[model samples]
Target: MKTNVAQLIELPKFLDKRGNLSFIEEFKHLPFKIERAYWVYDVPGGEVRGGHAYKDNQEFIVALSGSFDVLLDDGIEKKVFSLNRSYYGLYIPKGIWREISNFSTNSLALILASTSYNQEDYIYDYNYFRNYMHEKD
Candidate 1:
């Protein structure tokens, strides 16, 4: 299993006196084309959102408001990203275990996915993930 993780996308910020606008358009600014969009909200502080890995979906996560931390584990190393800016996004590739937590009040986590929702694509079990990842090779 390959556990290579890196930042792949960044939203462009257009600074203006009127208002600061940041945009992320699929296939134009994002690497993988977007097929779905979702946002996490109404989450109590210290609650976790995700604890799964995708088989073939790529996602770009942005903190539209407030702040939160994303814990990424590629089976080898772990990385944490504190997302607090709406103008910036963290690009997460496939096959990485992710956990989103520590949300501040009124925080919004916007995610742009490369694929539409598919229950079969989610590996929710940690041991299943390890086995499936090993079999992929």
Candidate 2:
């Protein structure tokens, strides 16, 4: 299996006196076509979300309302991405672990996935992910 690195992608932002607008079109602004769309909100303070890795799903996460931090681990290395802008998003490929935390009040996180929900495609154990990555190489 091939490994993909996480990256920050900038979206097109249009400035106007009325309000600022940003958008992401399927396969135009993202690496993969969107098969599913989801949003996370109403997170209490000091709470965290996401604690798993996808087997073949890639995602692009955007902070549409407030700020949050994304912790990504690719078995051997880990990185943190701070998302506080609507025009910037973090793109995470498959075979990586992710966690979201430190959300501000009324924060809205929009996620676009390349695949639909599949129970068997999730790896929630860090040790299992490490072993799986090792075995793949």
Which candidate leads in lDDT? 2
Q: Please report, in order, the local distance difference test score of every candidate based on alpha carbons.
A: 0.86, 0.92
Highest TM-score, which number?
2
lDDT of 1: 0.86
Model 2 / residue 4 / CA error / Å: 1.9
1-137, model 1: which lDDT tens digit per residue?
11245473567888999989988887676677889999999997678999999999988899999999999987767899999999878888899899999999999999999999999999999888878778876
Off by over 4 Å in 1: 1-4
- Output the lDDT of residue 78, model 1: 87
As for candidate 1, its clashing pairs are: none
TM-score list, all predictions: 0.91, 0.96
Error of 1 at 86 (Å): 0.9
After superposing candidate 2 on the true structure, give the runs of residues whose Cα lies further than 4 Å from its correct spot.
1-3
- lDDT of each residue in 1-137, candidate 2, tens digit only: 11277999899999999999999987777878899999999999999999999989999999999999999998888999999999998999999899999999999999999999999999999899999988988
